[model samples]
Target chain A: MLKAIKGIPLYLLALFLFIVTGLPFLIMFLTSFKGQMEFMTSPWSFPESFSLDNYKLLAELQFFGYFANSLVVSVVSVIIVILIAAMASYPLARLKFRLNRPIFILFMVGMMIPIHTTLVPIFILTNKMGLYDSLFGLIGPYIAFALPISIVIFTQFMRDIPKELEESAKMDGCSHLRLFWSIIFPLLTPAVATVAIYNFIHIWNEFIFALVLTNSTQNATLPIGLREFYGEFSVNIPGIMAALTLGSLPLLLVYFIAQEKIVTGLAAGSVKG
Target chain B: MSRLQEISLDTVHVRKKKKNKDTWVIIGFIAPAFIIYGVYVIYSIFMTFYYSTFDWTGIDANMVFVGLDNYIQLFQDDVFWTSIQNNFLLVIASLLTQLPVGLIMALLLFSPIKGMRLFRSVYFMPFLMSTVAIGILFIFIYEGNYGLLNAILEGIGLESLQTAWIGKESTAIWAVIATVCWQFAPFYMILFRATMVGIPEELYEAADIDGASGWQRFKSITLPLLKPIIITSAILSVIGSLKYFDLIYVMTGGGPNNSTELMATYMYKQTFTNFNMGYGSSISFSMFIIAFIVTVFILLGDRSTRGNG
Candidate 1:
């Protein structure tokens, strides 16, 4: 109760940080709707008349192709990674196996190997396998990088599940596979959601690989397309602003929808590590 | 056979078969992730090191083994050293500014202020958006003629302060670092705030009763409790800044004469732009070693800190 006055300064500081940090996003959003003349004349003002003309131009530029490509790559790779990570983590976390520690260490090494170190070789490998310039080429490397963290998260999550539950199921004459399929996987939804969201964002916003592996516009993901659009259409500031806004809309939507989970999930990953 | 001996033999046989089955089950479960990870990540790392030993452009199938020449050249390269220095600057900057700012933000939020929840989420917004998007936003913000930054300066009667932020060689890296700090400070804020929340309230209450000021209580109570997490966050920030690529890549392409060249972007430029595959591989290998050493050093520092404390 005595701290109510303290809240005034706190709120003021919060507002200051909020505006300082969020000013770019506010500017980006407002600038996207301004026309060329308006942008030039009053770059910081809100739009007097809302316009979607930049979006219309982007649509004509096959923006949806890039959107769909990003969606497919992020979603499919995350799904594959989730399934593989779940299967791998169950035994390591639950069962007593000879190779469990060694396997976990192997996954740990992946986390330490910076993605840049693997980039040149991945580029060469993808090209050799005829996957360069294809949307599919991104999936392999994405899954590989995604697997380490996914396995770690899944393993940590699985470790907390009581052993009595599995023991009871075993007493009911359940096979290991049936027990995992029926009982364990169902219990893993929250963990799976966390890993899925993390990987989805990672794959969606990943730039370097998408930059190197896929060269053609048709194969470009949102990041690549937005980058290419920025370079090729530097003259049209509003259009570039519009593309930036729309390009980030999907991720922003995901963040808003699962704000609690995203924050907690990322915190969980970093804190645990 | 005797009855007891026959029973023992039967049980042993059954247990052997079950053990064999379990081994296959383990293999089946772990194989998919392991295989993919092995091929793309672990194998690629080995291949990167192998490629470093050769003198070949990435364009063709042919290669010549050059032993350690690429590494020798990498050691001698001035630009490589410049990138390394830039990366060190990022690490120092993040340690000094981002962590402190994040800690301050987290501390401010520790109190039950009005609209605290909204402020927390909004503060983390920059971190949520893609780096590429942030890069584009900053590019517009830093535009020379009509950028928001210049406009703000002019509006504030500081026209002398306005300059092409990312366009000039001197200001490019600093501008890029500012954006990186903006994007990532929120990340550390969330991390530190989570740890701060776990601290017991009774400690603060006792300190208040003893008449300790806010800074005193924070120094004696919160800071000590949050030590492990502080180390962890520092390691994350340092390693993260070392491999920092996307935002910088998009913001300047390490440009205006390689002013913003990070180790990661330097590797990319060496490999892709120049087609110096061998040399690029050497740079990446060095990056890996540096990251490993930094991580190990932090862990060691953490251990010694814990030992002394």
Candidate 2:
């Protein structure tokens, strides 16, 4: 009887987390197909007809424009981050440089200060450079902000790459650039993949700087697009929901497809950090 | 013999020259990332400090330094205190709710269960979605009229319990905290489960051989092992909860009169809206001091725990 009672509660709790953790996403999915009257009347209920009406309406708009902008920014930034972080992390991990530890601690301190504190000043600087209202303004700071964590991830991963590779390359009298490019870069793909995935999601979802940096409708990214759609009020609910769904679907898909890598990436921090 | 010896020595010298160039190669590789990140982080921190003491708005050139005035004003400002209080409430709620809840989920999934791995991915669905979308989704959930929350309550025939959760001063902050905990708990749960997976299977088998029940095995094995991770996660939780912004901003807009305003949101408003640039920076500096102190405590605590373990 005691065992039976415990079993019941265990199942009940699982059911509860499953629901509470899940229902909001379910609602977002459900509401995208919901029409005005149906949404007002019954939000939790399934849509009366599976309608693409909302999706169809949103497609006619500049939907692809924001999608392109997000892709460009996130991809470009992720590429730059991986390249620069690979280069930076190699020495920090492998070399016995005098400044290496101090440089590493510097990154730790960088992680402490919230970027929001620096937003106003960066915005002012970006404005003065005439990079304001342009995509170029967003890229520079985005790379700057992403580098600390990327450097940390890469350097940690690089340490595990055996020292034999460097020694063997040296025995052959290979140049350092050639050694790294030919020997180390390919071996660090797992770390690069993990950091790239992490950075891509962050840049894709980021809103504040995108809002401040881009003034025109043409330049705004997906999150900013969502905020602007909010300003259109009640008439645009279905359209906005479609846009939100569109914005989030790619990430949801990637997370599912790369669940193992993502789980490994997360677990490393759990055990090690 | 002399000519042959000279030629061999020249080849050796060329090889050494190539290796020397390679030593600085690592430096060259890391330089760009370091330079860019270094300038931005170091420069912006002090620049904000300098601006905090001035009277000029973001656009203006006029700079007037009033020493310590902004810091003094931050203490007496009622809204600033309220924001700080709300942040405290979040720290408390997250510790109480998110941490334990994540542990429970982690433990449940940690045990052998059918389809638990599948459940893990599905459970993390909300964590992957944009905070902006989560924000909007909650606004719908908390809507006073024809909302999911009220509909569910009424369906269950608990009509009296229905109220404007995010719309009111009392419930608004708690409402935001609850959503945040729900969304993020899965992230921490995944982290904990990873640690759990690494524990040796032999320990559990040994417990069974000793006639230990499931409860006894979990208590003796799992709980004892999870301590380090729990400590690290707690520090992360504390630090993360302090900078809380995106979700709260989207839901309440810190409104029904400043109830859910976190430090980040409040800083944005003071600096950008009222143009109290100095005051805003002062509050930011204060928050930094608090975070640094907490971080020091975390590091010290981590060292002691790791040492004993």
Candidate 3:
């Protein structure tokens, strides 16, 4: 009985934190189902009826176009990041070269740079390359910004691979390229997963680059699309609510499905730094 | 003696040739990532500084070489100063709120509670959601009329406390800071939780045998062990707070008379909206310097403390 009483404060604290964190999402989800009039009448209350009207309205607005853009940009960037970052890590982690430490430090310093510092020049570069206002423009910056963390993760992981593996492969006359692809690359599955998950979430939701780089709805990623929805549907709160919920859904769904990998991946990605 | 010297020199020549080949291989491996990073990140950073010295609308070719004039103006600019102040405020607020709240939440996950898996899942949801969505959702939650926050306040009979949370300057920064904490606290929780999980079970068992209380165990064992992660989290929060843009931009656009203006937002307005590309580059360059200096200071402090310990 005493133990149970002692547990009450713990439960209360947990429940309080839960509500503080969870209530906005709950409100967002429930409010999304509400009609405009219903939301105005009772913003905090449950919906009058679960309705697909808001979602239907979103589909009419070509919501999936934004989804596809985000998917393409995020996937392309992440794949490129993994392949190239892993390749670079092989040399950086294992090779003995004159500029090795300096180069690694260069990439490490990229982590501390504010993205805004690079924004103007990249914007101009994209424009001059005739790639401004296109999905392709965003990819270059995305890949660039992602390299620092991805390389850090990859190099750290690669350094742990048994040196004997490289020596044995070298005995067979395995070129660096072949050796990387055959031996080092395959062992990077866990780090690759971490890099992929970490970068995907950031890229999918990446705003500033998308905002500056892309000028049209056709090229807009999900974050920009959500803002567009906000602007176009400002009066209809529930409609905006529906867009926010739907916009947030992809990541939320992915998180629920792969909860453990993502949790550990995110932790591992940052903790190593 | 001559034959032996010739053999050693031949081996040296061959070794040099092999070293040259190895260098090529290394360059081949690093070129792709390095070129992309160099152009977009390193090169752009220098170009930003170069752009800062000019008077040119980003759209036009009329480039006047202004020397250090843009940076000079930035020094006297009141709005820039305000944004700097606000950014520091955010840094302090994040460290104060996110770390402790995250630590508490992390501690709760380990408590003797039912449904922790559910708790952990829900707790981590905010971090996964895009900043834009969180910003938009909170805009409504902070809306004066028909807002969830006000409704709850009125229901609990705290009607006087209710106001347009993000509308008035007095409350606007705090409102956004609270949201920032909301979005990020869970991240720190995960970070702290990961570190806490690694702490040995035997230490706690030893503590329990010594009749140490819960708070004592945490203060002595948990806090001491969490030092490294706590430092890591603090660095992240400080740097993140300094460069924060998306949420504040979406929520208020540094509105209610520039109360919530951050360096990034101010830079955006100057460059994109107002077309002061030169001035904007100066602001952004300043942000880079500030973040770099702060990171260096923290790392130095960490190393010095580590050495003493």
Best candidate, TM-score: 3
True contacts kept of each: 0.71, 0.54, 0.81
Rank by DockQ, descending? 3, 1, 2
lDDT, model 1, position B262: 88
TM-score of 3: 0.98
By lDDT, rank the candidates, best first.
3, 1, 2
Model 2 residue pairs with clashes: A88-B30
Looking at candidate 2, what is the lDDT of residue A53?
88
Write candidate 3's Cα lDDT for A1-273 as tens digits.
Answer: 012226888898889889988999998899899998887776688898999899999999989899999999999999999999999989999998889999999999998899999999999999999999899999999999999999999999999998999999999999999999988898999999999999998999999999999999899999999999999998898898898898888899989999999999999999996
Cα lDDT of candidate 3 equals 0.93
Better of 1 and 2 by DockQ: 1
What lDDT does candidate 2 reach at residue A228?
Answer: 68
Quote the lDDT for B182 in model 2: 77
Per-residue alpha-carbon lDDT of model 2 for B144-210, expressed as tens digits? 7777888899999999989888988888887888899878898778777888888888888777789
- Residue A178, candidate 1: how far off, in angstroms? 1.4
lDDT winner between 2 and 3, please give it: 3
Model 1 spans with C-alpha error above 4 angstroms: A1-8, B1-10
Candidate 3, residues B1-309: lDDT per residue as tens digits?
Answer: 699999999999999998999999999999999999999999998999999999888888899999999999999999999999999999999999999999999988888789989999999999989999999999988989778899899999999999999999999999999999999999999999999889989998888889888888888999999999999999999999999999999999999899999999999999999999998999999999999999999999999999999
Superior by DockQ: candidate 1 or candidate 3 = 3
Q: Which is the better candidate, 1 or 3, if ranked by TM-score? A: 3
Off by over 4 Å in 3: A1-5
